[model samples]
Target: MRMRPLGRTGLEVSELCLGTMTFGTQTPPEDAHAQMERARKAGVNFLDTAEMYPVNPVRAETVGRSEEIIGDWFAKTGRRGEWIVATKHSGEGLKAVRDGAPISSKTIPETVEGSLRRLRTDVIDLYQFHWPNRGSYMFRQNWRYDPSGQDRAETIAHMEDALEALERQVEKGNIRFFGLSNESAWGTCQWLRLAEERGRPRVQTIQNEYSLLCRLYDTDLAELSANEDVHLLPFSPLGAGFLTGKYQGGAVPEGSRMSLNAGMGGRKSPRVFEAVAAYLEIASRFGLDPVQMALAWAARRPFVASAIFGATTLAQLEHALGAAEVTLSDELLEAIDEAHRDHPMPY
Candidate 1:
């Protein structure tokens, strides 16, 4: 696996990050450990998780179980130092954590302590805010997203408070770097600007949804990432299993993500399957495994630091690891671009 610079934090991460949201839910503990071992052998040293994880059906009782599983792996192998672990602090609108309280000065310290205990690590290599407190356009919320009512002055104050809390964590050696997820370009610019003015840690990365069917990051976020040095850590590069062709033709295999969340987290639409079909046809023409093709395509983007991928089984993990070595030709890439043009924002 090729390593890329994680902003200016003086740390490099693998091109592919092992995402662990499936831990303690879809995957058992032993299998989760085995997946990590396989990823380590493949030279994928980065691991990503969230505080409210195991999230097909996120519940209060199961919150943090994913982190606990990763902690167990560290304890079992005594190899905690080998991986660059990244996890998130849950934001507002999620009752599973802190009673749906938004991330603020009062919540950051306690959230950090909880993650540290569950992850069995002294310091988080990359600590991320799961979402913006004001709300986000992610998770198919872009259809009716309106931000005109937000108070700019209040938002700036909240950011300053959060940055102060993060500065304290930096002083105590609890975290090495900071990142964002499901955030807008404007919000990222504010964080960067504020951090510079206040001498706090700069934003290192942003995790957002990017796939064959979802190119939300292609315009503004892409430019911000390239010019500002905040890398894009794209989650769900496979489009919630749509790009993999598993859910094609209305086939929802047993124990599949679609079976649990029937709407596939609001990704269900008439145009989605059409988009998936086009990409699947491209994979067939190129004689490439669809899963590998989807992942390799997303990884080839200029601003991507690492593509975070999740797997519920060892076989799926092994299948996805092949993408670390797959390379697409110029003709194949052009074909994909055409496909995107033909089917933009299918969801």
Candidate 2:
């Protein structure tokens, strides 16, 4: 529950951000409220959600339900100012929202307004574009990613247009800062360049997947984050609960994510289980909870602003909260590095 600065925004956020992707779907409204209260009690002041949320099976009908649940909590507790809330505008290919509209000048205002209405908040602490309109290498796309079809000038124009709209949001007090998700180093650089040149809101954070199983950000993006002060808000630090050792030995517990989505969003693989076993062994040897080890490892990274984690139940949330106290020793970190070397990119 340690607080950290969110990029250069001067807004401090908890080291662990409570994720609400399951708030209204797998998790009921009352449970979601209890989770929020529990997290607040644990000193977590940051929450992350999106317009297209409650996503075990993201549905058009359930769209924005997670934010609505959070809004209800805010209304009931009257504690909106106690936390820094971050949410995303769905990008292209999310058919449930705006008919799969790409984020652009026209979409920014309405999307921000919609999120505000659902969250019962006036100004968003961090408004993130869920992904680039052109596309991204995240979500297992790196295996077949190709950028040859991209139009550089067109992409730059889109960035400029989106930044302009975001600047207007800043002026009108709709959003205080802007961020990106599922973006690449080059894409982030362009956003930073445009903001510097135009004096728009700086890209404060990059909320990408980073964990023991996913080290995609350890190279260029890590350097970019360190040098530019655009810290990372790593989502899925537990590898979608795979790192929690729940999916081991092919045991698909009922009501689990793997039970709902058999593939776990392409994360289930022979190599992945091997990687999980290796990390789990390390945790067992060190007498640590695997969930806390994985989350603490992600939070300990130099470029991480916060590690975003989701829990489907209060017990799961309490388990993750223990990570705040589980500090990895230098020897344990080295063991994790050794395991990574042995099983890199398991998924």
Candidate 3:
């Protein structure tokens, strides 16, 4: 596995990040530990989870269980320092956590404290906002997304205050760096601008959905990443298992994500299957496993820091790790671009 710089933080992370949102939910603690072990053995040094995780359903009862599972693994194996752990503070609209409170200066310290306790770590390597408090266009919210309700002055004030709070965490050695998720290009620029003006921690990365079926990050976010050195940690590079051809024929495998979340986190549109079929056909034409094909494609993007992926079974993870060695030829790249043009924005 190749290691890349995590922005300007002086931290090097694996090109592939293991996502633990499935831990303690569809996956048990023992299995979760085994998965981490397998990922570590495969040279994946980055592990990502959130406070409100184990999130196929994301119930209040299971919130924070994923981090706890990882923490237990750290205790059992004494390998906590071996991995660069990343976790998130839940934004507004998650009623199961913080009573749907938005992340702000008032909540940053307490949120960091809870994550530190659950993770059994003195310092979180990368602490991120799970989503923007103002709202975001990710997760298929783009079609109906509206920015008219935002108050510019209030938003800037919240960002400045939050930066101060994050600075405090850095001073106390509670967090090494800060990041964002489900954020837009404009919001990212604002955060960067404020950080420069106030000498605070800059947003190092943005975790957003990027896949053959969802190319939302290929345009504006792509430019920001190139110029600002804020790279992308793209989740769902497999299109939530769609690119694997498992759900191509309307076949929802018994334990798949679609079976659990029904909507597959806003990726279950009618046109999505068709898009998956196109990518699957490309993989088939090149004699490649669709899973690795999709992952490798995302990993090769110019602005990607790491490609975050989740798997319910060990076999799935092992298969995904094979992407590290499978390089796409120039022909395959052209074919993928053609496919994207044929079927853009499935959801």
- Model 1 lDDT vs. the true structure? 0.93
What TM-score would you give candidate 2 relative to the actual structure? 0.99
lDDT of each: 0.93, 0.95, 0.92
lDDT by residue (tens digit), candidate 2, 177-228 = 9999999999999999999999988999999999999999999999999999
**Model 3 residue 91 lDDT score:** 97
Error of 1 at 190 (Å): 0.3
Tens-digit lDDT track for model 1 on 1-347?
88888887888889999999999999999999999999999999999999999898999999999999999999888999999999999999899898999999899999999999999889999999999999999999999999999999999999999999999999999999999999999999999999999998899999999988899999999999989999999999999998888888889999999999999889998899998999999999999999999998887789998999999999999999999888899989999999999999988
What would the TM-score be for candidate 3 when compared with the true structure?
0.98
Q: Give candidate 1 misplaced runs (Cα > 4 Å).
A: none
Off by over 4 Å in 2: none
**Model 3 — which ten-residue stretch has the worst lDDT?**
261-270
RMSD of 1: 0.7
Q: Give a tens-digit lDDT track for model 3, residues 235-276.
A: 988888888888876788998888977888777877888888
How well does model 2 score by local distance difference test? 0.95
For each candidate in turn, the TM-score is 0.99, 0.99, 0.98
Better of 2 and 3 by TM-score: 2
Residue 17 displacement (Å), model 1: 0.5
